[model samples]
Target: MAETSRGIGGLAFDASKRARPPELNVLIALIAIVAAFELLGRLLIGDSFLFNTRDNVDGIFNQQRLEIIILQVSIVGIIAIGVTQVIISGGIDLSSGSVVGATAMISMSFAQVALVNGQPNPKGVFLEQGWVDLPVIVPVLVGLACGLVAGLINGALVAYTKIPPFIATLGMMVTARGVARWWSKGQPISFPTESFAAIGKGLMPVVIFVTLAVLFMVILRYTRYGKYCYAIGSNEQAARISGINVEHHKILVYSIAGVLAAVAALVLSSKNLTAQAGMGVMYELDAIAMAVIGGTSLSGGRGSIVGTMLGALIFGVIISGFTFLRIDAYYQEMIKGVIIVAAVVLDVYRQRVRSRG
Candidate 1:
């Protein structure tokens, strides 16, 4: 009886020592941000941040504002999903925004409707019209392939040649942007087929983002692939010694990131009905900020899909709140930069506390 009691006590003590999941902290931050906005709205404008004040609405919650917030963040959130994985695998992808630009141009060309209002597509990339109005799958596949190829190149460079991820992805960024410009000679590609356009219509982007987030969350938490990523990020030498294919896994991680970026491009272009050379400018930074704000350790070996989703929500809320307060765009940008830095600083502090513990 004495021995059993001691054992039980020890187990209880161990359990008590365990730290809470990081997502809880992020969730709290999100709630706090929302509350802050709500308070500010009431004090400053005699309005509500998330409640419907207009007489036209029957519900208390502002459904339109909620939808707008989610829709605005959904595309960039998709890119952040991939960025989360890459960062967890101990790498960065600076080329995702460029990949979006390039993929948008390339894929939209294939998805162009042969005729607009019974006339040839005025903004078509191909003059022959043969390349236009191909099946939706064709453009999707083409877009995915473009991303895959770019990702493969990024992976190969980092894994085989030992190029730093920053430099490699940066180079790819420039190259991919150039491709975006060159694809249509700096012209915009517009007028996609009905099927292609349907991909991003209404709440479709949110649906897609949520689907991918849930799927990858499962993959990262339960699969060997996820274990390898964590192991590699935690300690590359240890992972290599444990018989993991570090190079191959790194390549795979970056490749998936590229594909996700392409997915964002496809959705964005489809929704906007046009693909521009400058589409996705600074999106990489936004994706990275989302990941980092989600409690993803920039140092790697730590992060989650759930956290990223919550982070994206936080981002969306801040942006919406600012606009509600009528903040200037430049001031918003400056504040965003500060928030990003603060998140990174907090991450570093967390790492330190964990090490000490």
Candidate 2:
């Protein structure tokens, strides 16, 4: 009888330990933020805020505002997904924003259609008579190819040339922005095929965001590649000694990041029906913030796609909340920065506590 009781107690203890959820603390913080914002919008701002409609409890469920928030963050969220992989592999990417700009310009150039019936091509801002009517696939392929090449360059510089990840990506960032401007002489490239525009129209960005998020979640959770990412991020030298092809994997990871950035550019251009050389300015910062806010460690090795998705949601909600409260746009930016810093500090403190415990 005593043996049976002991066994039951042991089982209970084991279950309790296992039941302790990871990142519960972060989740709590997120909930607090939402609740605080909701209250502020309802009481302080009244109807002046973007999200303070009296008809619907701040109208978080308002289809139009929800759609707008999703659209606004979808491109940055895509880049954040890639950045998650890079950080998990013990690296960083500062070039993704610039990649978006460059890819948009270059790809839209291929999508231009010739003017017809004196109506001019509405898809393009500069309707070049010679370059219009190209197949839809051409621009997409070109954008992806550009992304692949840029990613490869970034990977090579870091992996083969022994450059620091930050330096390599920084160089790429500048180069890509220059390429974006040079492609169209600093002018917005407008006019894309109707079919091409459909890629970023309406709910398509949300669709792509959801699909990619699911795919990456599976990849990071179940595959050997995922295992290696955690292993490398936790300890690169140890990972290499264990027979992981650290260099090749790094190259592949950054390249994948580039491809994802291109996907973002495609969606952005399609939705806007015009590609600007400055289309993705400052987007990389937002992506990084999303990843970090989701509780992904900057030190690498520990993160999840689920966390990233949640982080994106948090970001969207915060932006929406600010607008709902009628906060000035500039003030919103300042508050976001503060929140990011607070999150990071909290994360570091948590890590320390876990280690001590």
Candidate 3:
């Protein structure tokens, strides 16, 4: 009986030592940042800032400001979700931002409604009324299809041609931006069908973002594909040797990323009732920053969607906080750059420590 009790105690000790809790450190940092911003808003800028008015504690709970933050971040958050997956698979995608722009422009062309019943709408960019009054599904499908093709090309270049992810995605980035500009000749496309506009109306982006997030969380937690992402990210050669079809998986991951970017594009264009060729400029960097800030390692093999979500929230809060503080827009950009660098440095430090342990 003594021996058995000793063995049990030893086993329990070993288990405790081996188990590492989920990285709550990022969450703590995020909370601290928010609190700090809130305090600063209250003490420094007072009521002059955008979201930082000090009528009372109740006024601090501004629904409009909260909704604006969520709305602003929702589309970027969706793209960040996809970017997180790619980063976890030890890859980077610079083209996603341009992809959003290109997809938005092209899909809007298909989603345009006719202003004149008989004659072509002079205000419309596309002369031919091919799919006028088509179901909302048409534009959505068009956007997804564009994304699928782009993702396939990106994946092929990286996985089969042995192109570096950076170079391949950079090339795609330029190409996608050029496509967006050339498609509409630098003109903004407008007049989407009411149904199409409805897709992004109200809190729809938030709803879609939340729903997709939940679905992806389940998939990443329970699916074989998610397991393989970690395996490849941790060690690609080993994953290949394990017969995991690394190439196919890479394609799938990139495709999913593309699809998500396309969805973001659709929502953005629909909400604005117009699609500009430059709509998604710099969004890729923001998405990557969100992933990195959320504790996703750029070195790969370790991350969580929850972390990405929190990171998005942190980003929204910071931006809103800055506006609340009545800071100059240029200063906000500077602050964002500094924050991103800090996040990357912290990620590297954590990686080194984990490796040593």
Candidate 4:
């Protein structure tokens, strides 16, 4: 039937339209930068920058450097996945890093082992309450609970109370950090159970990050929540007019972001085998940078989890490249700032292109 044929054709066009602005741009950028670094490596030291030519490490690539880059990016990338959703929904979360710190301190309290090296845990602050050496699930649950509560509070302020997201999350950032420090009078918590430590050991962090990214990517592309998120971000008033529950949706978004931050904390504290008040310093910034660089619009309504993943890789490579070149840490920070601004500018330009097109 001609009518059926036309309908099928229309559907195909719609699908393609939705997937417009492929990740080719970001992917190309990634490849180009890696090439630049490779060229630089040859010029600077006559060594391979992206490949392993030495006997100290395994694989054709520099396995040690590769692992370091992946492990470091994986932790922050987890947080970025949640932040990507928040930004896509036309909101921002400034409290993720503090949430990570707070969640780490709180959860590790429950994860502490009864004995450390055959001795009672010297660092167990909750031993007096018999909270030591709990099952691995206990600490994980505690961390998620902390995140849920923080998210609820943030949602209440931004949704029902109509407070600005920036201010509400900012207030939470300070409050959460203070709670982290006050949890045990500024003492670091250590001596976690073997099971808890195993969660982030070796390449596990990268595995977790990649898994979560894939799951969320599917959610964003195929679910009602994803559609509503984009609708709200594209135009809140329009979404509300169409009967979407804007306030409740925002609450859910912030809450999910909180949970991801907590998850990041669990992995981070596990990797370090300690929970300190100073953990996750500036993590929120790094997560935001990852999302922004991956081509997520701060203004909202346009982004993909895949793009964020690539952005995270770019971030890791740049950091690793800088270290490879022996660039100063402080200078790296400055360059990072510039790159963030450039990404946002590019985002704006893309938006203009869409509007004009």
Top candidate when judged by TM-score against the true structure: 1
RMSD of 3: 3.3
Model 4: which residue pairs collide? none
Residues 1-357 of candidate 2 have per-residue lDDT tens digits of 646545464643334433244356557766787778767866785543234454646545456766776677888999999999998888899999999999999999888767645677655544544667788998999999998988999888878887888999999999999999998788887767788988998889989988998999999889999999999999999999999999999898999899999999999999998899998998888898888888788889988877877788778878887887777899989988997898679779867976775
Model 1 residue 90 CA deviation in Å: 0.5
Summarize candidate 4's per-residue lDDT along 1-357 as a digit string, tens digits. Answer: 646545464643344444356367888888998889889989997888789998876789877887887888999999999999999999889999999999999999999999877888999888889988788999999999999999888877888888778899999999999999999999999999999999889999999999999999999999999998899999999999999999999999999999999999999999999999988889999999899999889998988899999899889989988888888999989999999999999889877886885
User: Which of candidates 1 and 2 reaches a greater TM-score?
Assistant: 1
Q: Tens digits of per-residue lDDT for model 3 on 52-76?
A: 3545545546667778777789999
**C-alpha lDDT values of all predictions:** 0.93, 0.84, 0.86, 0.90
- Tell me the deviation in Å of residue 1 in model 2: 13
How does residue 247 of candidate 1 score in lDDT?
Answer: 96
Q: In model 4, which regions exceed 4 Å deviation?
A: 1-22, 55-58
Poorest 10 consecutive residues by lDDT, candidate 2:
12-21
Sort all candidates by TM-score, best to worst: 1, 4, 3, 2
Q: Write the per-residue lDDT of candidate 1 for residues 286-345, one digit (tens) a residue.
A: 999999999899999999999999999999999999999888878889999999999999
Score residue 2 of candidate 1 by CA lDDT.
Answer: 48
Best prediction by lDDT: 1
Clashes (backbone N, CA, C under 3 Å), per candidate, total: 0, 10, 0, 0
Clash pairs, candidate 2, are 51-324, 113-132, 113-133, 114-132, 123-191, 123-192, 124-190, 124-191, 125-190, 125-191
Global Cα RMSD, each model? 2.2, 4.0, 3.3, 3.4
TM-score of each: 0.96, 0.88, 0.91, 0.93
